[model samples]
Target: MLLKTFGWSFAVTAAGLALAGVLWGWKGLAIVGILSILEISLSFDNAVINAGVLRKMNAFWQKIFLTVGILIAVFGMRLVFPVIIVAITAKMGPLEAVDLAINNKDKYEHLVTAAHPAIAAFGGMFLLMIFLDFIFEERDIKWLGWLERPLAKLGKLETLSIVVALLVLLVTAMTFATDVAHGGGDKTATVLLAGVAGLLTYLIVGGISGYFEDKLEEEEEEVEEAEEAERAEKAASGAQKGSQGATVVGLAGKAAFFLFLYLEVIDASFSFDGVIGAFAITNDIFEMALGLGIGAMYIRSLTVYLVRKGTLDDYVYLEHGAHYAIGALAAILLITIKYEIHEVITGLIGIVLIGASYWSSVVRNRREEAAGGEDAESKAEVTSGV
Candidate 1:
């Protein structure tokens, strides 16, 4: 599997270069390779987390995640989200804004940098959730029985990430609430607005859309149960096949559509900070796209590798690790929202947390094994009456 992945990685990297060559000859290819590596390195945790989610989906949805899902990451999030960010924050026309970004790279970069703090705040809160969840949750072992009910009930505090974001937001709101007074003007206000938009998007679509989707899913399941009960006798015959076919088809379509839908949103969430971070390295859209696009391929491959290797199932704590990474990244992104921290720092923090989780998981596995061995020995002695 490793060899296969390496082969594909090479194929993708080479293909990306070739595509770059077509676009702008040797310079583009050089930029493409460098950016791809940068993106892949920066997004390691994302790939691990995506694998965990992608594995939960059916094969069809997994394919959708790879194919269409890549498009969303590469083009939708990387290229377009920046423009959307500019559009919301800037006074210029949309095309004119992009043109400004292209022409006046430094000025547009200032806009991207200005937008980073709120982005960091959101990602930081998210990453903090994942981290706390990792430490407290009974994912691999149930060592902390006392904390379980409370953490489970209250859904964990995630105090650090949230507190930081609120502070940042408060400062931002007060400092930049009215554009006329503050030199920063409406730019800060626009960022806060964008943060609300992100929260609302997550709330409305993830919260509301998810609610209706769940309702429809339940109803569909009920109908299927009823159908199964009615068709049980005739299930062996061709007559029932004609009747049951519609039910099966409907369920399959619904599942596929939702699987695709969720992946898209998840990809968007994962890409949010990374896209913002890309501008930090270079504002040239070509480099940003190629680098981020290459990074997107790695994310795809990681998802596939996880699905193929059943790594999530094997590691047990990996999903927890990824979520922790996401929580941290979310927090870091939120920081970018108000402050001017480097993207590399944010990415590194996420990577370190994930690495720590994996290390912890290893130590945890050893301890559990030792405990089990001791228990088995005690049981053996008891059986022997010794």
Candidate 2:
């Protein structure tokens, strides 16, 4: 199972090391290893959250997520996205930006780092909305009842997440407004616009998935009714066939398309910190890509493993912890716009929250099992006239 699941991860890591060696020798390969560790450390929460989303998708889309999705994460976000930001922000041609990255590495890093405000605003807002939506939506299990219960009650207010996000953007923009006049070129306005773009992207992507999910539900219901009436003896098998068939045939194409896009955007948001933080470690663009690319490939494989093995179902509060970590990360990203924060601190915060939540889940499970065992024992005693 390990080989089958993580074979690609191993292959990619080997390839990354080989390519790094070829490009810049053993020293370059070592840099890639360090960068890979950094990316993995920072993105544990991302892998968990991705597993949650991937669990909801059908098999076909899950395959795309592993195959095509890895390509986008490794290439688009890790390599090309930063270059595009530099090109747009510094008003340099793509080739010129590439040249700068190669020769004038410091200037390239400066240009990319300078664009952090916009990048943070966009990614932070998107992730903040995700966290807000998760907390607000009603759930049978409440990880933190004191906090989550109140949030769920507040969720009754329509568009509450959007409203809260807008208020946050407003305050953040105003806080940074002074810097714009100090030669930051309207940093506040750029942040506001980017935040709005993030919000809109979430809404559009979510709306598309929801529409298809509803359609799939309706089709499943019809299939169930037809199966019950036509073949009562074979109802179970027939219903299974109908559901799988609907997913494979009717629901696979357009639904998977939007879901694939949604997953990609979500992955991109998670990569924002990793990409920016990489500059602090190395100014070599190819080194950053190879190292972070290997880390990203492993994350994709981890996502697939979580989905296939039903890890999310096994660990009930894992998703909650991941979202809370995301919320913290989002806040940090926005704060970084005004104050520089170390990536180590950012990564540790996520690790701590997720660890705590996992511990809580274990405690909850054991307590419930103990209670169940006592109940069973009591019933046995009464039935035996003890």
Candidate 3:
């Protein structure tokens, strides 16, 4: 199962190593290895969230996520996005941007790094909304009841998350926008605008997806009612038929289209910091793309694996951990705009939060098993007594 699930990842990793060797010999191979590790370490939470969303989609959409989405992640975001940023910001043409990256590596890195304020605000705001919306919505299962329950109550007030997000963006602009190191001069306005753009992107994408999902739900409910009504007749006639009529399709058609777009945007927001952080390790655009692309293959495989194996169902709080990691990353991105925090630190925080949540889930499972055992023993004793 593992081999079948992750064959593509293995192929990609091999290709990455070969590409690195062909391009820059042994040193390039080593750099690609390091970048791949860095990318994987930073994005485990992304895999978890992707799993949660991907499972809701059908097999066809899931395949597109692995195939087409991987292309976008590797070539589009990792390679082209930075060049476009530099071209726009430096007021240079695409060819000049490419030339700058090749001829003046430091200048290329500097240009990309200089745009961090806007990137951080935008990605941070989008991710923050994702985290806030997840935690605020009421759920039968609560991972961090102490914090989540109260927040869920507050979530009863519609737009609470949007309001909070706007306030945070305002404070971020006022506080860090003036910092000479981060948001120099008029950059604060740029950051604020980017943040608003992020918010709007989330609202528009999420709103469209939500509408289709609701329609799917209503269709499923209607199908179930019809099925129940006909069950008696079918049973009396000694006929059995498989499920039919609208069948609660898993994010089919237009629903899948919009959700796919949502997934891509979310994936982009997750990768924004990773792209910026990669510059800290190496300034080579091709190297960054090769390494991160290899890691991205594995992450995509992991998402599909989790969905197929129903890992989220077994480890109930795993989703909670991923969202919390996202929340932490969002805050870190915003903080990074003002202060230069190490990528290692950012990665570690996510690992720690996810690790703690996993441990808690294990403990809870053990306790439930023990309680079930005790109850069974008591019931047996009473039965023997009778």
Candidate 4:
């Protein structure tokens, strides 16, 4: 399973490193290697969150995610997207942006950094909404029962998540975003506009996805009802009972398409920091793309691996951990608009939260097993006494 899942990632890693070495010798290879590692570490929680969404998709959509989705993530987000940002911000053509990226690395990096307030506001708010929605929703399993239970109860209030998100964005725009020390200009209006854009994007995409999901659930419930009726009829006739076939309802058509869009947008939001942060390591745009592309391939593979292995099901708190990490990343992105925060700190927060969740899951599983064993032993003793 490991090879089946990660074979392409390994291949990409080898090719990326080989290309880097051929272009810039040992130093290039080393930088590319470090960038790849950094991207992977920073986006591990992204893989977890992606898996949670991907598992709901069917085989065809999953294939599209691995193939076409990787292209968008690699070229679109890693390469083209930054150029577009620079082009728009610098008031230049796309070709000019490309030239600046290749010939004048320092200028390109500076332009990108200068645009950080708008970028951070958009991406940060989008991610913040994701975290808020997840926390607000009621679920049968709560990892942090004390906190989550109360939040879920409060979730009954309509638009609570959006209200809180708007408040945060407003405060940040008025305070942190207005500081000129970070980027030499007041970006209050820029932050407000971009943040609202991000918020609206989330609402539109999430609303569409939710509608399709509801339709899918209704279809599945009807199918189950029909199956139950068939069983009842068979029992009435005293026919020989046979095993019923399993029913699988996979998202398709418009539902699958919008879900795909949602997943890509989520990837974009996650990549915002990684893309900006890579400039610190190397101002070479192509080198950053190659290294980050390789890392993205591995993340896609890891997402599929988790889905295929049912890892999220086994470690029930894993999704909660990922969302919590996302919340932390969102906050970090907003904070970095005023003050720089190291990528290591961002990565470690995710690792620690996910590690704690995994450990807690293990403990929960062991307790459940012990209780089951005790109950079985008691049953056996009672039967013997009878």
Candidate 4 per-residue C-alpha lDDT over 205-307 given as tens digits, one digit per residue, 9 for 90 to 100:
9789878877777766766786688687754232312212122234445677888899999999989999989988899988999989999999999999999
- Candidate 1 global TM-score: 0.75
Residue pairs that clash (backbone atoms under 3 angstroms), model 2: none
The digit string of per-residue lDDT tens for model 1 on 215-306 reads 55675687678678667755456565566666655665565566566556656666766676665456787678877887787778777887
| TM-scores of the candidates in the order shown | 0.75, 0.93, 0.94, 0.94
Superior candidate under TM-score, 2 versus 3: 3
Between candidates 1 and 3, which one is better according to TM-score? 3
Q: Candidate 4, 30: how far from true, in Å?
A: 0.7
| Clashing pairs for predicted structure model 3, backbone only | none
Per-residue accuracy of model 2 over 263-340 as CA lDDT, tens digit each: 888889989999999988898888998899999988888888988888777778888899999999999888888777
Model 2 worst lDDT run, 10 consecutive residues: 177-186
